[model samples]
Target: MKKITTPLKEKDIRALKAGEEVLLKGVIYTARDQAHKRLCDLIKKRRQLPFALKNQIIYYCGPTPAPPGKIIGSCGPTTSSRMDKFTIPLLKNGLKGMIGKGKRSAEIISAIKKYKAIYFLAPAGAGAYLSKFVKKKELISWPELGTEAIFRLEVEDFPLIVGIDIKGRSIYDKR
Candidate 1:
């Protein structure tokens, strides 16, 4: 098992072997389907995105709204396969990491290897528990997309397991 700390370094991710478990800490961005589409369009036209992509982590989820006095609502990993199509292009633009649940497509796996990126899996069906780790949330873009809006989440000691590595290896498939 490996430990992945915040301001996540590519060396740590690249050193991770297939089937290794990892605990991740630090901030991660949130983007759902609609936001992803808009991001792709922005990338295509060479427009600036709300956040810089370098050395960042993008979590694929659309969390429930927070209740009073809470930093965030039920936060959990969404299915990752939905974001597969957007993965390659985003990776090309400096996206180094992803967090989500379930398997991604072949093309995405290929992109990960090409881009030297990593994918982590957060616990599924544990939204409320995960919400505790989020300290704050900022809507970054595509607010008109409703829950599908992109959010920049500030987290601390966010739990995670290494799902896929830059070498096109996956933990889930080995199991």
Candidate 2:
């Protein structure tokens, strides 16, 4: 498995291939559907985003509240396609990578290639297991959104599979 850190660089993203396993480290932000909408709104209004999109990664998740004595709770990837409507703007805004579950749409695949970005698939139905990898967590914005709020997490050796690479290769494609 390839081991990498964030914020992801163009070189690192380019070096990955569809279906490759990876161990991701460093910071990643969690954002679910609602948070994604808000972010897209920010981008559309030409307002500053809560975090830099350039060379950064967003994980599609709405983590449960941290349990006592644990740094985090069930935190795993949500479906990737749910965010498709908002993806292009983020890519254009310089988002380097995304970590989520499931396949992406054709348009998103094309956008990923056009923008030189990447999509990684985190293990689904493994939130409790994945939480162990989170070393730290901090709310980034919209606390009212609860679990759907954006959060910055510091993770170590988080496992993922390359769902789509910059070259337009998709794991969902026929062999």
Top TM-score hit: 2
Angstrom error of the Cα, residue 68, model 1: value is 0.3
TM-score versus the correct structure, for each prediction: 0.93, 0.98
Clashing pairs in 2: none
Off by over 4 Å in 2: none
lDDT of each: 0.84, 0.94
Q: Assess the local accuracy of residue 145 in candidate 2 as a C-alpha lDDT between 0 and 100.
A: 99
- Show how many residue pairs clash in every candidate, following the order shown: 0, 0
Tens-digit lDDT string for candidate 2 (43-141):
989999999888899999999899899999999899989999999999999898999999889999999999999999999999999999999999999
The whole-model C-alpha lDDT of candidate 2 against the native structure comes to: 0.94
| RMSD in Å for all candidates | 1.5, 0.8
Residue 110 in model 1: lDDT: 82
Candidate 1's C-alpha runs over 4 A off are none
